[model samples]
Target: MSEPLVKEYSNGEVTIVWKPDLCIHSGICLRGLPKVFNLKQRPWVQPEKANSDQIVALVRECPSKALSVKGVRFKEKDNSDVKVTLIPGGPILIKGGATVTERNHKQVHRETVAFCRCKRSRKFPYCDGTHAQPKED
Candidate 1:
């Protein structure tokens, strides 16, 4: 596999790192912080529009893990106890550094992974945050 394309936007205090290849185009970032993440803008991400804490919080909600924060290191915790949470009509959030393997026996290596629940994701198995969209009657 080749190296993923990474773009970084800075606001002096913190930097927002975006990896396009990893992004499934989930609109979570835009929904979470419209001022910072504008799709129509030349540079979609404007980190300066918001503070570091707010930015980091929104980044964590990114279903694809494409949006990440730099300059802030979260302290590592003992991940012996894993947690699988259902995001209330959204995806199934798996945390605690668990290993996920596909039916084909391929192991998915990631700190966390969001499994699709509503079953409307363009990217199957993983959530692209499509569940947040309004249902068609």
Candidate 2:
């Protein structure tokens, strides 16, 4: 019910927009371009480290639509297939434009999303990186 958190990182030609609230921490960005999406670093995103084209390509791979480039339009994924993947210790990743029904009976469609399986996320159905944190007894 509040505004989603958005952060921007620019390399002049390309400006990467990040919506943390929509992020599933799928690691696609990190895995594709570690130099630009390093989690160990402060700010976490360093668009300046990579070329604009490279950055844009990786941002497009984001399943949750959490990462985007300013002034750029991403092609929608084909909705013909829906697949679900269960991570070993993380969230459940769903792809291919799946429709989700919330507790309030609101249905939402996502091209790619990660649902919380650890049952520790404050964000309820969505994974907010809480599963990666050390647990306390």
Candidate 3:
């Protein structure tokens, strides 16, 4: 197998390297920091867009092992049954063959679910343009 493309960014304190081939394109990086991880750009992932702590947090959220902390060793989980995605400013999207039981409904389906995090969503349990809304100072 060929080596994956790795991009590195640093702000003197620490550096972050991203492996695109391993990435699932969950959009977590871009959503977390558009100024850095602009998908529309030729070379995405600008470390200067955010601080080291913020970048590390977003990278750790990646479901896929695409993003990793530079020089840090970690173990890979067996993710054979679950599908994970890191959406920008949105909930981590998860889908695939799974079972979800509700109050009166026990459904087994292949569907995508978006979990909310911004907390300003009109659509609870999911994101609905809430992240785009301007925040009040």
Give per-residue CA lDDT, model 2, range 1-137, as digits (tens): 88878999988788999999899977878878999999899889999999988998888889899999999998786755888899999999998877776776578988999999999999978999999999989
For residues 17-116, write the lDDT of model 3, one tens digit per residue: 8777888876767766788679787666677768887877777777786887787665664667678888886677787654444334555454766667
Candidate topping TM-score: 2
The residue-level lDDT of candidate 3 at 72 comes to 65
TM-score, structure 3 vs. true: 0.50
TM-score of model 2 relative to the true fold?
0.58
The lDDT values for all models are: 0.85, 0.89, 0.72
Q: Alpha-carbon error at 130 in model 2, in Å?
A: 30
lDDT of 1 by residue, 10-103 (tens): 9998899999889897677887899999988869999999998899888877878788888665554455678889899989998876676576
User: Candidate 3: lDDT over CA atoms?
Assistant: 0.72
Candidate with maximal lDDT: 2
Which 10 consecutive positions of candidate 3 have the poorest summed lDDT? 97-106
Error of 1 at 52 (Å): 1.4
TM-score of each: 0.54, 0.58, 0.50
- Report the C-alpha displacement of residue 2, candidate 3, in angstroms: 2.8
